[model samples]
Target: MDAFYASVEQRDNPDLRGKPIAVGGLGGRGVIAAASYEARKFGVRSAMPSRVALRKCPTLLFVKPTFEKYKAVSNEINAIFHRYTSIVEPLSLDEAFLDVTYSKYEMQSATLIAQEIKNDIRNELSLIASAGVSYNKFLAKIASDQDKPDGLFVIPPEEGPTFIKQLPIEDFFGVGKVTAEKMKANNIFVGEDLLAYSKIELQQMFGKTGSFLYGIARGIDHRKVKATRIRKSVGAEQTFSENINDEISINEKFTQVFEKWWERYENHKLKGRTVTLKIRNFEFETITRSITETEYITNKSDVRQKLTDLMRESIVAGVPIRLIGVSISGFEIEETDTEVQQLTFW
Candidate 1:
């Protein structure tokens, strides 16, 4: 799915096709949820401020997000994935990893399976999808982004190590801005640079994440693709167009966020013990307070009281707030029987 939200908008509306477009709120505090490739050419990107994106692409069209429609399309895409393999791990609404070592269609080559999946999506849904086929998740994930729109790339086992050696440190999956700066400071600017340090040395420099960096630098990813992934937390946040300092206004805003969170919690049928309250002030300072109960919080009043207490403790009086969020975690895991199959080598 290329520029998923924007693509969907374009597919549904002819006027938006081939035009720079963004999907999100078109307000002062709004962020771009997704940007079309046309908009990307002008340096617009998702998570960019709406105003900033507008400046980057003055002709950028803003459309309000239709999440319900996106979710429905995501379900359709997942259904297509199921036709090939049951071992599908969804990263988000737009992307997933499929382990096709023993696919339902009895495909021996993962590349062929990827092409078939891409074709299925395009032919059936009238949308473009890119795919990466590799022996492991890390290389596969990296390869997936190498092409644009309707494209497929394959990284064979023999090419993985050499390919990784020349790759930039910033391009690694887990290397974020802060981590990349630390790596650059240590002269670890590329995968080949990482090879100069031993695992112990890397660990000393990067803490726990160093071990992961060491493995990926050598194209040694041993992670399995799990079909079922347990969600750790469910949360929602709202950014305000105007800052509110008064208690009445703050309470009203908090209630709105709380209601949205409650709706999601009920929809997921989640039972969790911890409730967290998050607040961001006008100065951009953020704070969070949480409460954990001995048992699962089963009622709205109980969660609301916990959030109210957290808000009372965390918020500064007369300080304008710009955002509010609520979340619940520490969910009880229900045991379910799932059959694990041995990988079949071709």
Candidate 2:
């Protein structure tokens, strides 16, 4: 699924076809959930401020998100995946990983299976999906995203090393802006550069993450694709219109945000043992404090009290705050038991 939400809007409403559009809020403080490829040409992207996106592409049209519709389509696509292999690991509503290593079709070729899936999506759902076929998840994931819209790329075992070597360190999964900068500072700019360091040396620089990086740099990823993809956490955050320093005002905003978070948690029927309070100051420095209860959070009042206590202990009354967030984790949401087979799709 490419430009999922926006594409759905385009598919449903012919007027939006070929036009630059976005999905999410159109309000001043709203953020984009997805953007059409046409909008992407103008540098608009998902997670961007809707205002900033409008500034980038003045003709951009913002449509409200239709989660129900998206989920329906997701279910349809998941069913299609099940036709080939039950080892489908859904990453989100639009994408998943499948292990076709022992597919029911016994196509015996991941590349062919990928093409068939893409064709089925386009023919049946009137949508495009890109795929990557490779021996391991890491290489497969990178390959899937390498091409656009309706691509199907393959990374055979023989070519993995050369391909991985040329990839920029920043492009490796899990390397954020800060880590990328650190890698560059240490002359580890690409996969080959990363390969220069011994495992011990890389570990010294990146701690536990270094070991994972070393394996990927060598074109080795052994992680299995689990059919049941359990969500570990869910939360929400807000960036204030202006820096807040007053205690009463901060708590007021916290209460408002917590209400929104609680509504979502209940909607998902998720409970967790830990509640985390995240705070960022005017200078952009951020910190988090968390409290884990012996029992899972059972009520809004309990979470609110924990949030109140965490904020009180963390915040200096007059310290201007740029952002505040609340989150809960350490609970595994139950997953429907789908069967197992593996093939890769982006």
Candidate 3:
């Protein structure tokens, strides 16, 4: 999926094809959720402020995001992936990692499977996808982004170390701007530069992340592709059209937001021990407060009481509140027995 949300909009509307478009809110405080390749050419990007994006690309077209449609498309893409391998780890709505080591179709080469998946997506969905096939997740993820708009790239095991050594430090996964700047300050500009430092030195400088950096620099990522991921937290929030200062108004709005979130929580049948309250003031200062119970808060009354207590402790009197949210977390993992068969190479 390339420019997923924006591409979906373009696919559904012919007028938007080949035109610079963005998917997001068209408001003062709105942000760009996704930018089309045409928009990207003008330096527009996802998470950019709508105002800034418009300023950069005056001809940019803004379309409201349709998440339901995107999810439906994602489902279709996932179905295609399962046809190739059972070990599929979804990174997001638009991207996933498929371990085709023992593909259901009996394919031995992951590159061939990748090509077939790309072809299936294009032939069936009328959309373009970029794929990266490599021996591990880190290299594969990096390779995937090397090409854009229906591109494919592969890094065999023999080439992995050399390829990583040449990559810029900033291009490495998990190296954000802050971390990149820190690495640059220490004269670590490329993956090869990282090899100069001992594991102890990196760990001292970056804590747990340092250990990860040390391994990836040498193309040694031992992480497995998990077929399932745990749902960490479920929460909802609302940004008000206008700021509310009075306690009565705040409480009313909070209740409304809480009820809506609770309905969603109930639908999922999720149980959690922690209740969190999130508040954003008129000045955009955000604060969160959480309370963890000894046992799971399964019923509405128990959860509501916890949220109410958090609001009382967190909210500031007379301060205008622009947003309110509630969430539950600290879920207890349920164990179940399931088995997946895979071919063992002799």
Candidate 4:
């Protein structure tokens, strides 16, 4: 799935084919969630301000995102994957990693399986998908995005190093803008440049990240394909358009945020102990005051009251708060059978 939201629109509507489309809100505060290939040519990109995107391409066709429809298609595509293998790990609604090492079809090679999956997506969903065939998860994920929509890329173990050395550092997974900037300052601009530094030197320069980068540079990733990835943290943070200081105003804001979080936790049936209040003053200094509840949060009103109390105790009326966040920690949401069986035994 490429340009997922916009692609779904194009797939369902024949008239939208090959047309520039922007999905999400089209107003001033709106941001692009997905941009079709045609939209990309016009400088429209995901997470970019709608105002800027429109200025770049005056004729950019704006389409509101229909996540439900996109999710339905995603489910269909995932069903297609399960036909071949059950070890499928979805990164998002549109992207996934499939472990076809032991597949249902008894295929001789992973590349063939990838090709067949791509073809099936196009024929059944009337859309395009790119497939990556590699020996491991890291290489497979990288290879998947190497080619564009309707493409297949395979990285054989024999040519792994040459392939990795030539790959742009920016294209390497987990090497974001921050890492790239540091690498640039150190004159390690690409995979080949990264390969020049010793593992010890890299570790000294980048701490834990150094070793990870070195392994990727050498195409020596040993990470297995993780099928059941769990959440590490679930929190919401927001920066307001302007600072607010009135006690009434801050309480209102905190209440709204707490309500949203409570709903999210309820929908997912998530459990957590820590309740953190993150605040930023008008001068731009940020601070967090968190408390771990003795018992799990089971009510929305309880969280709202606790968060408001922390906000009041932490900041004064004179201090204008620019941002506020309510965060929860120690989420052990998975209701495992072992735990359930223990209860039964008791």
Which candidate tops lDDT? Answer: 1
Using lDDT as the measure, name the better of candidate 2 and candidate 4.
Answer: 2
Tens-digit lDDT track of model 2 for 178-292: 8899999999888999878989998999887788888889888887888876666667788887789987889888887788777767776767787788898876678899988
Off by over 4 Å in 1: 200-207, 262-276, 281-319, 334-346
Off by over 4 Å in 4: 237-251, 266-346
**All candidates in order of lDDT, best leading:** 1, 3, 2, 4
Error of 2 at 217 (Å): 0.8
State each model's CA lDDT, in order.
0.87, 0.84, 0.85, 0.79
TM-scores of the candidates in the order shown: 0.83, 0.84, 0.80, 0.79
Tens-digit lDDT track for model 3 on 94-131?
98888898999998888899999999988998888999
Residue-wise lDDT of candidate 4 within 251-302, one digit each (tens)? 7787677666666667656688877888988766778898877788776767
- Tens-digit lDDT track for model 1 on 1-346? 8999999999999999999999994788888999999999999999888888988888999999999999999999999999999999988889988999999999889999999999999889888999988988989988999998777988999999999999999998767788899999999888999999999999999986788778888999888898987776778888999999898998999999999988888877868888788899977787988888888888899679878988988888888899999988777763242212212110
Question: Candidate 3 has what TM-score?
Answer: 0.80
